[model samples]
Target: MNNHSRRRFLSDVGKGMLVAGIGSNLAMELGISNALANDDANALTFGSLEPLVDLMQQIPVEKLQPALVHEIQRGTELKTLVAAGALANARHFAGHDYVGFHTMMALMPAWRIAEELPQTEQPLPVLKVLYRNTARIQEAGGDERLHTAEPAKLADTRRGGERLLKDMYKGDMQSAERTFAALSQGERSNAYNDLQHLVQDAPDVHRVTLAWRAWDTLQLLGYEHAHTLLRQSVRYCVEREQERLKKDRPEPALRKLTPRLLDDYKLLSKKTGLRKTDDAWVEQLAQTFFAATREQAAEAAAEALAEGFAPEDIGEAMSLAANLLILHDPGRPEKWASPEKPKDSVHGASVGVHASDSANSWRNIARVTNQRNLVCSLLVGAWHTAGQTGYITDSPFAFDVDVITSKKLDADALLAELNTAVQAKNQSKAMAVVKSWEIAGNPAKPIFDCLRRYAVSEDGALHAEKYFRTVTEEFTTTRPEFRWRHLIGLARVSASEYGWPAPGRDQARDLLET
Candidate 1:
């Protein structure tokens, strides 16, 4: 074994091993590529390619043909080619291009495509190719056309479904349901399941998606299914978020709940519950929520109300909802009514027009009147409780009455007195006097005379007339036993004094006869 011979032998062995290794590596690489090609070929088509092609063929050539031409002119990159392949498979076959030709070749059965490839190296270039081809096809109005359910449209739908699923997983069911509804059933199912996994791991997300799905399903299915779904979702949310729910515990739970507070909570619960039951419940709940929480529920309820919910129902729902909300945190301060006006304005005792000299009582009456203005309905209810509309009637001013009187005075004397008051422009005094006389239960002659004589001068006369008309109508309709002899008498005098024609005097005559 000479040195030269040993070196040559070593070199030869190294060369042979290197060559063998290279051959093995190439074989493995080729084998892997073939397997990948095979897998790619078998990848899901969702549906037949011909249908997509047919649909694409139907798309206006002007709209889709141009894009295909542009892509062909541009030639295909891998992304563009993949896009083209997808387009071709989806039946968007416009015409041949180097990229599409290569893509089809790569996807050919003899190519032995793979099931999946690393995303970074995946043939997204095919997408660009497809885009260009589709563009040309769309522009030229070639064989390939766009349709409502084109591959591109379906791809977009799929993308939207993915986004919706993500949102649902994050506990945005409303959005998810919306996205789901826009998708085909297969896409919807995929999104729904994705959301389910998210819900299981992240309960908040689950709760939200469940509620949204339930609500959406209800729209599709009906009440029973929807309610069941809602209940299930709510239960899941409530249970899963039990720790969060604990935040609602009142600091001092032992305090006796005020009737008002209890009422508020009851109202809130009722409103929220009603929303789950009635289609229009959302509107009412929103109103109640807003009323209770100073418009917190406004956004939620706005859509429902805009769709046309009844105002009264909304009001009641808001009241109920507010009550429920208050129960969860009863430490809220009470809202007080505004302060009352000074008593002198109301009792008229300061004007010396009334016989009642009870100063403190008059002041109280004024205070009550001021309160009445602030809360008319509440005050009215309270008055009704007191079993007397006459509480207002018996007063020297007769809060409800609007007239003037003067006993032992002729019509001329009454007119003169009224005229003097009018001339002096003592409108307040005139009204006060009129109201006093009416309160005193005087006959209509003096009251009507005073009004007619001075009405031209006194601004209060307008208010007086309205009151007179209201009272006259009420008395005429309600008190059948009391023939409106006073009204008739006053009408006759009014005609005489005002110098109006008596063409309708027959009506007055009939009233008198009655």
Candidate 2:
């Protein structure tokens, strides 16, 4: 094809088509170009990821949905498509771009969502995120860049983790990457465990969730790619450390505090306890964390673990402390009502959401990590929750169930009221309805069923899907009496962001429907 002919072909294809949503060579292999009756094209492909990753990166933003939908129809596995997206993201953005990483956070949740949907519609969530993924790749000009760091030798096997943390904290990217690469070759779980130090370095939602999500994604992508997946967290930590140093911010106190807490509590030497505590103990621990200073919170958590309280029980208390932030949040109504505020500003990405996600991550991390990391994670979760003290109002976000005329409303009626409150963006009413349902001895299933509808449909500023999944997983892991609280938090947040659809949600849906 001549230059003029190619130009004429692009113009004839319509300006709205934007970039191609498949690699040029793969397009040829799939006979996709022949389908379009075009014969000539040029593009780059990375043999490491081959056709799928290249195809994902080449996808035009406007056509990602239709393109993915086509691939699904042609017998492509959804997991393969998602793996490609993850590889494409890690390769291009290397865990640096805001949009790139947020999309990365959503990948596993989107895959989970796809599993529950009917076959034809299963790809919706996957396509929605891929659209965002490819759009950012398009904006950045493309995914020609590759992760170029070569693996290095660890000087001392016993102290590699220590050296890695020190290098990361000092903003030494080259040293950290090399150290992480060396560690990545040793043992998959051990490699993942070492990085938990950085995940718990501070309470940033993106940092914690990305680390957890990347680990979660490994289950799908397989542990063989663990190094590539886990490297994102290392890079993220080094980048943040660099920024903090450049801005002259104080070193995060947790850097020093976490290690001290582990030693003072003798936590590193103790085995994680398996004894579950009673409801009163859980409540008391939660209150202690709620009112304690950051140091006090860490101490209380250390003491609990030292005293043989189950890490899950200790985590339950931290989870309650997080729910308290949402239940007691005092932001003015206009803050949520503003068109200018990001949809997730108050509810989706609020301090409460961050706390919940962070606590959830730390809790799960404790389950899989080594004893030292388990100890560090519990302490970090408590400290993170208590750090948000300024956001806790004098009272709980008002959800007086006493206002209801009758406590005897059946499940359907209660759910109706809950949906009404959510649609109206009435946070207080939503909480009241959920509490009423809980008080009525109703099964929690009906309520989760109600929230699942909104979770799948709303854009939630990229948070709804993940937070809902977080709450659902935590519910099963939490004690019976306290489990209802997670539901109430979800209800309030779902209600708060009820009407704000994701920016391009309609277009993605329309593409799928047609």
TM-score of each: 0.17, 0.87
RMSD of 1: 34.0
**Residues 303-393, model 1: lDDT tens digits:** 3333344333333333233222211211112232112212112211111111011111111222222221112111111111121122222
* Candidate 2 residue-wise lDDT, 425-454, digit = tens: 888889889888888888998898788777
List candidate 1 stretches off by more than 4 Å: 1-408, 425-442, 452-514
Model 2 clashing residue pairs (backbone)? 21-59, 327-397
Q: Residue 297 of model 1: what lDDT? A: 40
Which candidate achieves the best TM-score against the true structure?
Answer: 2
Evaluate residue 110 in candidate 1 and report its C-alpha lDDT on the 0 to 100 scale: 10
Alpha-carbon shift of residue 384 in model 1 (angstroms): 11
Runs with alpha carbons beyond 4 Å of true place in candidate 2: 1-49, 140-146, 332-345, 403-408, 507-514
Report the C-alpha displacement of residue 325, candidate 2, in angstroms.
0.8
